[model samples]
Target chain A: MNMTTRVSRLRGDRVTLAHGGGGRAMRDLIEEVFTDVFRPPGREDQARLTSEALQEAGAQLAFTTDGYVVTPVEFPGGDIGKLAVCGTVNDLAVGGARPLWLSASFIIEEGCEIALLRRIAATMAAEAEAAGVRIVTGDTKVVEKGGCDTLFVTTSGVGAIPPGRDIAAVNIRPGDVAIVNGVLGDHGATILAARGDLALSTPIESDCAALGHLMEDVIAAAPGMRAARDLTRGGLASALNEMAAEAGVTVELSDEALPIRPEVRGMCEILGLDPLYLANEGRAVLFVPEAQAEAALAAMRARPEGEGAAVVGRAVTAGRIPVVTKTAFGGTRIVDMLVGEQLPRIC
Target chain B: MNMTTRVSRLRGDRVTLAHGGGGRAMRDLIEEVFTDVFRPPGREDQARLTSEALQEAGAQLAFTTDGYVVTPVEFPGGDIGKLAVCGTVNDLAVGGARPLWLSASFIIEEGCEIALLRRIAATMAAEAEAAGVRIVTGDTKVVEKGGCDTLFVTTSGVGAIPPGRDIAAVNIRPGDVAIVNGVLGDHGATILAARGDLALSTPIESDCAALGHLMEDVIAAAPGMRAARDLTRGGLASALNEMAAEAGVTVELSDEALPIRPEVRGMCEILGLDPLYLANEGRAVLFVPEAQAEAALAAMRARPEGEGAAVVGRAVTAGRIPVVTKTAFGGTRIVDMLVGEQLPRIC
Candidate 1:
């Protein structure tokens, strides 16, 4: 089927209250849009995965949750669906686990277009497939027009941590190196542009790709990797602060080595926002042993998602300043979690 | 802290744009409400559980998702929070698993009362505690005013199924009896009354209790139980139809044996609705061997959540009708899923 055009040709132009009704209409809608996209061929009620499978796999599950309420449901290079899948998967991946199954819950507005819903579902299907994870089960609820924006998706994921692999923010040591996979702030810039608040013609696309596959390789290469966290919500700055606080150490970043897109930097410069604090769906902050920094960088650069990976900084001795960024101009600035969200609903 | 009046005494009277910003305000709000209620005392970021616990327990995981957008966030016997926890836990329980941990994702509207949110969180804490499950992880997002209703909650739960316990709708067989854990339609009716859409003042409370403990007993008493489903949005009628359709058999209900309350029946009658089709939050429809039906009922009745448990019907050999209910008037009528939702956002 031509997925691109199929969504537009759906029967209803706008969702009605009846679509959310747990009845025939709702069932047909789900069958046409959701089940058709997520389920494999010839499976009925594919949501129900048996416990026997988990038992046989000897799964040591790492579960995490994320809420996506990005305004302008469709954005440059990514949509809410793509971000939802990647965000949750990355959460599990950073927690030292091999991502497996996901449960998605959608809150849709009554006036949301049926076509838009279908397109989002298609995007989620493709992304889940690309990430090698399954969207095993989901729930959908539609509310009145004023009740919500077009759509909000909440995803909870489960992954199995490989035996003997321990990952936690507390694992970082004073000498550990901090590495980021790919250019940061693209997701923040993309969402900003999509909202049309800046009215800039910048071509910054969101870096909202699943990083589980890349993390899998990184973990294998650097067995002593301390921990990892995706740059989301409050971004790289928040992540560094969290790691430092949890480990009770000081983290220092070399701004010259940071990987950032020029367009994103430009957008932030004009918008009075900091790239260090912008969300990145695909980027991850990995802490590795100081001796293995070069090897870890090489492993990360070998993957497409991590081709731009760089060693941004290192954990220094415990100090009063938890995080500091040494600027290219030969000065340093303390970095802390934003007292208030600079951008809301970006994820 | 007095959980009763603690909510109203919170510093902020209403949720603001910054509350969802992933900043200090958000952290404080969560700590005062969510973490305060759901977490163990004196823990930082208390919403994470180690996979080692699950591994030691030998958990065979069952994961399920549900979104709660029930209008009038506060209902008669329960609020959206209580319903959200019970709803997800019941999903796993009815799947023949012992409910364990849950991930709660909340979408809040700007200007939503902080006191209201804390109250909801308190209710959720109570419900999760009573159900013997942990609110292990969650995400919170806020939208601009008019972007959403007061609040919506999406919960995902994981549970462990005991060894050798296999349950699925496909396992249902001819001559199997259908048992309902308790009274039906109260949840649907309670929401309607709470919305003030119905001018009825009957003290009809939602049957929104977590049924995992009771289910554990029923499963032990009736190891031959074929399958089970919670009667949520579409209630008992839809469940029976689904089981029959899946098992490729005819399901016929004895009208006289149905355990619906007089108040619920009267509400349905006045609303021109069928109690069989209304939703039930704390009810379960179990398919079991007819010979063990009595034992199953006894096991269910031993618990308060299942006190009204009764044999409502039986599955027969393949027939033309998927579901048929005998009426009190000595007539048989086909029971199908409602063509449209009787009420939107009832759960």
Candidate 2:
């Protein structure tokens, strides 16, 4: 397959309705911008994949999907393409699966710059390569101007879970220790400032990184890991509350022990917002047996993506509230699920 | 697991930004509308799947994806949700895979009615059940009112292909028989009329149907099937051209043998369009060895979705033109790929 010849066939600087019409133009754009970078095996309608892990006796297939419509398609640390890949990878990784294959579908509004699309595709290719996942199959659709924002991406992934790896919120025990991989709210804070809606500028960049490798290491260190959840939309507060409810226990967080950057904290205070509820793309909370807490933290700290790992909380017997935080001021406060929109399109 | 209480928590008449904010509103909407209908096994970030087919010694996994942004959101025969499900299923079916699991991601515009969303979700549920595939995992994002049209759906699917079933265009050989399951251009014609831009009205409905069972039956009958392609975006002409190019053979279509409705033909003539270039969602082109062509046709005719199946063309020795049509007027003409948009967002 001579990609050069195929890519040379593209004749436009911007996307038009023709690029999504299932015609020559559409083929040219897809082959040049996507397949050229991803290099899928065949031109077949579906990608045919084979993996030894899939044939394992008790391997379970893990499937996940996410739609990315973040405002300002490109941000300081990452673009929507990067988020699309990392978000789906984390969804599978947090489930105790070895992330493998991804499928990306793009919905582009007419008149979007072709160069921008190429950049997004390139970022996706780079992210997939870094995470050791193959982008196998995809689709593209074009809508008239005003039919959609510049572009939106939806990525779906499939992975394999080894036998006896039963990771779920219900498996969390009362004595389980909750650990976080990094500082919270970096992504949310960056996006809020990037949007320029509040005229507040900060040097924060999105903490958007793939956690597959970090997760694999943590599981290896803590063989009895109970559950893990990515701190995406709704941040740490929502995740802790859900985990507590599922296990019918209470999660108590130590405010001082929680890893939060001063810049993020300052931004939260100025906006009268709770940092715990701000989103983070690269952070996740893991529950492990109390004995393995140190080992889990050590494993996480050994990785660049988890260098800020810390123990923030622990599960206790059922109480009046599912989650509570012990404040630095020597008082405990209930932390409940967010009731309304705090930050839309934070992801 | 008691869905009644979860559903009772929803409190809204229309979708707001909060429903997508990863808060209580988002949880209520997802649980009541999507999870309740799809019934994914667990609340984990990913769906854990296990299948005996996946464990077969030499089986391969088939993956495909598609994004649907058809205008009007609803047409006579289907809505965006139905198209989202069937489009991905046919993509896998054409690859000779037994479609099994699908993940649907939705990009919704704010201010959309909750009642309409329920209708769309219900339609997707019904379609997946009929296709014998599970809606295993999904994600939803909401944008501001002008960020997108009412809604767009992207569906990615995985299936299993038994060993030695290498159905691909490159496998096609000269003298292979070509067949189509049903009418061409019904979907395109229906959408055009439904758009109300041409001041035309017709009883024509979109031919949106899942062909997984039909493909399975045909494969069983004709074990020597060469290749199959869903006649979607660019219709039969484009599919035939692609197959011909891949196999280095010439495809000759008999104009009189094509299964086209009178309404579609009339509409095409009035609008200066070619029926061969119009899209069909429920139709597919299949190639099989001459010996098993009769069995393949018989198997297709036995199914309701393929009752209108007919032999329409054949592959011949390589020629100057990859695709040509034998007109009823006793002359042959080149059938080139569509150069520009005939119909956008038809699917």
Candidate 3:
């Protein structure tokens, strides 16, 4: 049997602390769990390729760092390891960079199971490889309990920004079109479900994917696209407000154009949450010129990661606040930036 | 009063949820705390300058981000605010970057006093201004009371790296000179004292500061400096070991050349904690070429941040472990990376 296929079947066992103690258990976890999960597509010959060389792509490099202190390190659809790789790589992708290298620092809690730790590390390594990034350097420290929650992963990522394109929030402007790559609130809802508090269940999964290629396609199709932001922390509302405030323009997103899953919307309704302010681990908001809106949408929809890509909003000359909705009832309302946290640590 | 000083002293009677709400309170915190703290030494008049053009100093840019999950965000010598800026800026500094722009995100617990939140934000802002970086973008989210422990600040900083310099662990070689920036154990010892454990009393403050200029001087003097690392988590022992392992060489240190405050040493002796593994917030180890060792040392010593800089060791040809001596008894011991947590939540 091939390495990855054989390893994928061993995901049922619970993790132990021994897996993290740099022993045989740890090696197995890396080989069986991580290597299996992160095995790159089209790489049948695993022995020849070193883990480091697997992640490097292109010439120029982009490096960014992020720290994850999610209240519960292990959450539904993801854990700290998954979040670390996705978070760091997303930053590079949205910044028009191809992720290449990542250095992870794990602040583990005392008495943490070796298996759990190994699982997390192996997952991170595999995720990096899958995302075309290397787990280059790592530092581990075991903090006493309560000094840190079970595990916190801080990742420093280095990538290569494609030449001939510049993307920043300041590049946004009036008369630009805003598009969303996919449905929102899946990540946040999945997290809440994982908490087991609401007695709700849904076949929801996070849309976490490395967005570099999609962004590259969009930029290549419409080089004048002003800005691209990943809607992670503050969601669509927060991201729009930021762009409007930074670019000094008004943003108006259509109510019908926003692609939110029914499960996510229902949960938000029951929990008194606003999906606009909810987090999305795997999504992007693109600001492009009016003339290129169709091209941008077409480019996004061409990728498997952007099947739900749609034109959600546009920049206007009038108004200062971010507004939304020509509701089914023919009502309009302002979609203000979230004044408070809706669902915390959903990232 | 100047804008920063005026903003710094605007203490509130109490902190409200809005302070962490990402609205008016957050804006106030940014205007009052951050702007004041991070204002350049002589250019306070240009305090209102928010343009990125006014911020960039050098040619190449290096960006790094870190989240401060240190328990008891407020600690002796400095608090989470100072640590957030110093720790992140230090990372960039060691990478030979001149810090320019910083983005801050605050994850605050519900029911936290707005005043306390204000105090921390003010401290963070002041520190950033002091380090000559702009607080350009920020996010604030409030979790349920127990969701997060108090307040956590994540700062992402961007800086400019000098041309023709790419310092990495692989640059180190046998016979390279190792120099430490200052006295060790201050941050860890002070933290212990603050915890009120064992009633250990010492007047040591965290050695936290922006090391950008200090690094600039070192690189100017010895452009071929092999590698630089900040001795933070796992302290000096961990830092040394990681460097040696990365370079595939052995490291030897002179106990006499190592700097340890008397009170810290005494506390370490009593608590049975190896001060070597204790964390240091503000110190760094610089690996230099044999030919430029003296010049690098001279450059570092001339800076205020590196007043006590000294060459403490050299890379050796064999042995996987780092070794240090207790000069008093002529006993030698291996200085190993920390096996686990020394003190948790320390930035």
Off by over 4 Å in 3: A1-77, A91-107, A111-114, A120-142, A152-178, A241-257, A268-274, A313-322, B1-67, B92-106, B111-141, B153-178, B219-228, B243-252, B286-297, B310-342
Better DockQ candidate (1, 2) = 2
Q: What CAPRI grade goes to candidate 3?
A: incorrect
Question: Interface RMSD (C-alpha) of each candidate?
Answer: 3.0, 0.7, 9.9
> In model 3, what lDDT does residue A98 have?
67
Tens-place lDDT per residue, model 2, B1-347, is 55454336767688999999898899988988899899988889899999888789888999999989998899999999999899999999999999999998988889999888999999999999999999999998999999999989999999999988899999999999999999898998999999998999999999999999999999999999999999999999999999999999999999899999998999899999999999899999999999999999999999999999999999999999999999999999999999889998898
lDDT of 1 by residue, A162-258 (tens): 6567788888888899999889999888888888866788877888999998998888888899988888888898888877888899999998898
| Native-to-model Cα distance after best TM-score fit, residue B152 in candidate 2, in Å | 0.6
Tens digit per residue, CA lDDT, model 3, B279-323: 787899999989999999899899888988988888888674555
- Root mean square deviation (Cα) for candidate 2: 1.5
Per-residue lDDT of A72-138 in model 2, one digit per residue for the tens?
9999999999999999999999999999999999999999999999999999999999999999999
Query: What is every candidate's C-alpha DockQ against the true complex, given to 2 decimals?
Result: 0.52, 0.89, 0.11
Q: In model 2, what lDDT does residue B302 have?
A: 99
Q: List TM-score (chain A only) for every prediction.
A: 0.93, 0.98, 0.81
Q: Answer with 2 or 3, whichever has the higher TM-score.
A: 2
| Global lDDT of each candidate | 0.83, 0.93, 0.68
Of models 1 and 3, which has the larger DockQ? 1
